[model samples]
Target: MIGKLNHVAIAVPDLEAACITYRDALGASLSQRQELPEHGVTVVFIDLGNTKVELLEPLGENSPIAQFLERNPTGGMHHICYEVPDIRSARDRLLAEGARVLGDGEPKIGAHGKPVLFLHPKDFCGTLVELEEV
Candidate 1:
């Protein structure tokens, strides 16, 4: 099933400003900005010792992050990702247990360049859960 806490994603209005806040103000090292057109987000990763924090900015109007921003103008936690030994197996288990998977219920390439699937928020205490194959 799920393994270690992979990363926590935050939807932000401004990617640069968020990076600056984490870099200059919080003394965190930021990774290079990566634009994921397929997922519709431009992201920056703040590397913490054990886990990473992902800052996401909408790449287009249809981006999910954009909708999230519309709800919380100042931005907020978008989702939390957990590592999985095998994404397909984990997905099947979740499906059998009656958990809804987002999108087509298939894994897509995620920010980490790994196969990832997002579970429905309502199925997980209103918190979006992402499972990444490690």
Candidate 2:
């Protein structure tokens, strides 16, 4: 079941520059930053009140964000992640509804060590859907 609205991820080419804008300029504090080699990207989190704004920078050409950035030259919001009580069940529900997954099966390592699965945006009205177990 989808629980809470988690952090909104924004794709950016420069994580450091984005962090400075959100932190020093916008008054949001840097929460955390992590590099996921498997995903080929680096993420920096900025706490904004109760929610967090995540900045994503592609580590290489194979990174999902790299493709995103290439398409959107301005670099904007990439995807929204919703917290779920049980990711496996959530994914099952989505798949039963004819939603396609990027991977063959099972949850994968996500930002902040969360287990996550994605539902094809095309099946969900072009909104990229990410399910994370909190």
Candidate 3:
């Protein structure tokens, strides 16, 4: 049902600061910043050898990341994404297993421009799970 770990997402109060920390402190290479308006986030991806880390900042007041930051002003891990060969098929299987999909239970275009779905945290040991079609 899950493939490789795609990326780990962290909500940050300041995206640039987070980028600087990863770049200067960790000496990590980063991808260009991207604004995902539909998802209401500004993101930067830090590439590691086998996986990636995503830093997210709220793009607007209504952004979910903003709400997350409200609860955690310092920001923290928001979700972890996993690759799936077939998103819809994976979604269906998760559904059959009684896992609740977030939103409309339909896949949405994610930060990687791939079909992605989020599962309820309560169903996944209090960790928000994101499935991205590889």
TM-scores for all candidates?
0.95, 0.90, 0.95
Off by over 4 Å in 2: none
RMSD of each: 1.1, 1.5, 1.0
Which 10-residue span in candidate 2 carries the lowest summed lDDT? 45-54
Residue-wise C-alpha lDDT for candidate 2, range 79-118, written one tens digit per residue: 8888998888888888798879877769997866889988
Query: Model 1 residue 101 lDDT?
Result: 95
TM-score of 3: 0.95
lDDT against true structure, model 3: 0.92
> Clash number for every model?
0, 0, 0
Question: TM-score of model 1 relative to the true fold?
Answer: 0.95
Q: Any runs in candidate 1 off by more than 4 Å, and if so which?
A: none
